[model samples]
Target: MRTIMVKVKPNASEAKIISENGNELVVAVAAPAENNKNPLMRVFEL
Candidate 1:
């Protein structure tokens, strides 16, 4: 599925991905080996 929207909040200790209508997608953040959480997620979005 293609992503309609994405948001990253490293400072707030959270990362969220919502649909076109404010519905959040289910995803999990793992350890540091992912080369920073947001970047991994961002790439996954692509």
Candidate 2:
């Protein structure tokens, strides 16, 4: 398994990987930051 740093932007207009710097990533998701939903999963589904 591999681990990386992810910065999440919830409630975005769309889901996407905004930027990646080495092991760090900035991800945006349309899902709100609530209800225990995994924003990363939403990004992957797109």
Candidate 3:
């Protein structure tokens, strides 16, 4: 298994992944930070 870091940006325009470089993975989510409603489902959908 390859371990990587996920960077989530809440309340953005749309849910999307910025990039994956080195040991870091940058992503943008449409859901807000409240109630843990972040759009994490699309993270591993890549």
Give the candidate number with the greatest lDDT: 3
Note the Cα lDDT for every prediction shown. Answer: 0.41, 0.52, 0.54
Give lDDT tens digits, candidate 1, residues 1-46: 4443333433434444334433335444334434555443432343
Each prediction's RMSD over C-alphas, in Å, is 6.2, 6.2, 5.1
**Better candidate by lDDT, 2 or 3:** 3
Segments in model 2 whose C-alpha atoms lie over 4 Å from true places: 1-11, 32-46
Question: Which pairs of residues collide in candidate 2?
Answer: none
The digit string of per-residue lDDT tens for model 3 on 17-42 reads 67777655666555567845544533
**What C-alpha lDDT, on a 0 to 100 scale, does residue 39 get in candidate 1?**
49
Steric collisions counted per model: 0, 0, 0
> Which candidate order results from sorting by TM-score in descending order?
2, 3, 1
Q: What TM-score, over all chains together, does every model reach?
A: 0.21, 0.39, 0.36
Q: What is the lDDT of residue 15 in candidate 1?
A: 45
Model 2: per-residue lDDT, tens digit, 18-39? Answer: 7776655656546566843654
Provide the global lDDT of candidate 1 against the true structure: 0.41
What TM-score does prediction 3 earn?
0.36
Off by over 4 Å in 3: 1-13, 32-46
